[model samples]
Target: MAKIAFILLCHKDPDAIIKQAQSLTAVGDYMAIHFDASAPRAAFDRIRAALADNPNVTFAKKRIRCGWGEWSLVQATLHAVEAAAEAFPRATHFYMLSGDCMAIKSAEYAHEFLDRRDVDYIESFDYFQSDWIKTGWKKERLVYRHWFNERTQKRRFYATFELQKRLGLTREIPADLEVMIGSQWWCLRRRTIEWILDFCRQRPDVMRFFRTTWIPDETFFQTLVRHLVPEQEIESRTLTFLMFTDYGMPVAFYNDHYDLLLSQDFLFARKISPEARELKRRLGVLYAAEGARFRISNEGRSLHRFLAEKGRIGRRFAPRFWETESSLGRERELLIVVCKKWHVAKRLVQRVRQMTDIPCIDYLFNEESCALPDLGGIQSSVEKRHRHRRALVRMLFDYYESDRLLVCLDPSNLDLIEDFCRDRAVTRLLEVECQVSDVFLVGHAMRVGLAGDRTPRETLNRLLPTIRNDMVHESDRIRDAQFDNHLRLREIDPPETNARAIAAFLGVPGDTAETLAETDHLFAD
Candidate 1:
């Protein structure tokens, strides 16, 4: 009887829930799924049938019909909370999960982490700045101004620019706390779930907002949690936000910002991709990499190897957006650094100056910068000098507010640098330490062990060749066999057999056999 009641919301994608449930089996887990009433009965029936066979699963009643822009999602989840409370009354905690999310940590670590936490691992958010209220709160004064005001819809056609300028927002709103919505994904203690239900039920006005609001699902729950526990430690950056989406979301090393997530530190990433399926198969390798302390050389070396292979033709290839020039014909500026020992920063500045004609600067800090040669000094004072030099490094970065390409040579040390740049709206930051090796493919490997997504056969055809040609070539051993095996399968196997073989080979992230099989035609001539 694990304490965490994993409550899942299943809508159109029963497969996602099924795969998620199946993956949980490795961690000694049980589940409760609330299939939305709007979902096709046939699909819901299939899921129910599967749960019948799975001892860990308890199918929840479909009580509410949730739509994309409505409050039904909130209502449905609340119903699930009620159902889970009644069904698993003895459970210590209740984790609210989506069908698509994949657990990032193993059972032991997750249990231990939850056991120690005092408050619910959940938060609420709302459009506190929206105009409908016409209240005293100046929309401009709120922290999430841009997110509430962004014209994603064409409802008002007049005086928008004039109004924004009057409000004192001169610059284009950058992606910040205001622009981005909170994650629907959350973990909560059982008491918290019960409390939320009681609180929302106590105030029907909160639930009634569905009739007038859009995407209330995103903010309602977040707002409630923040109100209930103002001082509780909350992480807005969910376990899912990829530290870097610039590299087209491939396997890469974790940086400092990721440390916040590591603190909660579950085993699986949110929304693990089919591309990363094979990598997920090797969880032992991934867990080790995720928990590793800062060691520059090791990370740099591993990165170099992985990237070198990424440049090869055996695996799938997607051109990085950075490689292309802007519509203005400006060369996309990129700062790439390989931090070896001392003097690396000096060389970086020199290279940036020489490589481009644009405004360029770099700062390097080392023992040489000190005026007093520590010939007679002890080791402690020498270390202090290095510390002072490190502090000076921030000044150079502060010179530019935004619109600069900042690259750090040692990515293992990138966490601190990334946090510094994230708040600034004008800078585009890229950190490449070394390359990725097989260890970078740990999630893909774990998907192997889990028996990955059963995507359709046709989808695999077009996708497989690219993966085999571009991404998979890094590991000659796997590449050699996989290439031959894929060719043979194309010639002999039907969609189902080929799908299984592909899953077996790639160990895809979660179960996507049906979807992958459909892609088979794309691979054909």
Candidate 2:
């Protein structure tokens, strides 16, 4: 039988930590907790008194005031691990946890999962080779000494970094070791833990180097593990499930994520919001009831595929799966017509149809839909936006049996705009930005049911942000369009453009292109 010891690092919310400890105590595994010195002493006492009766729970004597991206955190972890080792000598593995973490599965399952694998489970990505750090420096962090805590002392932190960059000051990294980066949380074998502690004892200079390294907690053990452990025996991924935003911030899991969490088999999840009381209660019930609430999505069952998406985009933002690589839009030429408003897109399509023989259709996405397009086989469905969008493109071409087709879209339909703009078949794109005159603003507001007993100026003030955001999104898409080799894109904002390019794309004589330059009045009525 494999014995697992837990090392928990806690800084806040004693009640939650105590609850976690009670659950772990019931599991009969020894757990060592380290409370930050910065936290109230009353909190530590409350937690300690609550868990005093549990023989398996122990608190580290040395409390360090931990600041984010500071060396104190690693010190705190070291103390907790040491305490856990002394308290439970027969421990086979050490699993790291935080106050925010909760076990998703039973303790026996964790032990059995570890028992089946002789390999050490920890995320240790090559610092230079992999893009493990999303928002932080990679090489500079290891090479230069960090002087201040980034989160608390932002000014000094950046100033010192800039000074180091300007002065070309760098610290010497141990040439023998490879710089590895990973989540600070891990499940390590007893041998790996002993080796790391022993190596630190022998290599005091290496410890001294990392003491000043930026966010050493993330790299200290991760980089050191590779020095002793062979690559073949190390599983380079975490047992804990964590998701980060594009800005490299961990998203706090809440009640809304319960369905998503039931789908994953990861041992634990971290950074759970303390305010998520319902989520916490449901999770407790899930384990107590043996997962009566656990259910896979309909899409996952019916489509014979995992319905969940990746990152926060899938977990929180989207309701279901979106297959970008669906076999619908393969090898087809499409002309994208877009506007901020569906009314503008609809009218723009009408104008394009009159000007050219190319087939143009409207209402790709009209969320505040007043009148939906009655076109058969090409109407947009929210459930399958990509499928319906590709169908619309196909219908236009198949209806005319032409090589290319045109489809109109609203930029305000944020979900579909980017995908279509960068779609492989999108060889041509035209975006119309209707100039918001006083009359048009009022008319647009009234049309969209936004104008309610307000002056046109007030409507403009209220609606300017939406229009501005749409324009900004459109601008970003057009800027990104240049990178897409297949895309030939243009924006008719302020009714200005390169006449020759517009003339060529529309297949119209440049001399007769007055309509292209003065498009502000197109929706003024």
Candidate achieving the largest TM-score: 2
Tens digits of per-residue lDDT, candidate 1, 233-333, equal: 55543433223233434334333213222323343444444445443344323332334432111122222343354444332323225322212112223
Q: Per-model C-alpha lDDT, please? A: 0.45, 0.68
> What digit string (tens of lDDT, one per residue) describes model 2 on residues 1-525?
677788999888998888887776565677899999999999999999989988889888799899888888888898998888888888898999998887666666666778998988888998888888765577888877887988888899889989998999977778898889898989999899889888888998898898888888889889988889999989988888777644557768887655545544577777678888888876654433331432322121211111122112321244224444643355766666666555656665576677667766566455424334445734546444445655545555666777667666665444565555556664556655555554554555555544433323432464556645545655565555463422222344333354454555555776544475444546543
Model 1 misplacement above 4 A: 13-16, 22-28, 53-56, 63-65, 123-181, 233-264, 274-525
- Distance (Å) between predicted and true CA of 507, model 2? 16
Which regions of candidate 2 fall more than 4 Å away from where they truly are?
285-525
Could you tell me the C-alpha RMSD of candidate 2 in Å?
15.6
- Lowest lDDT 10-mer window, candidate 1? 294-303
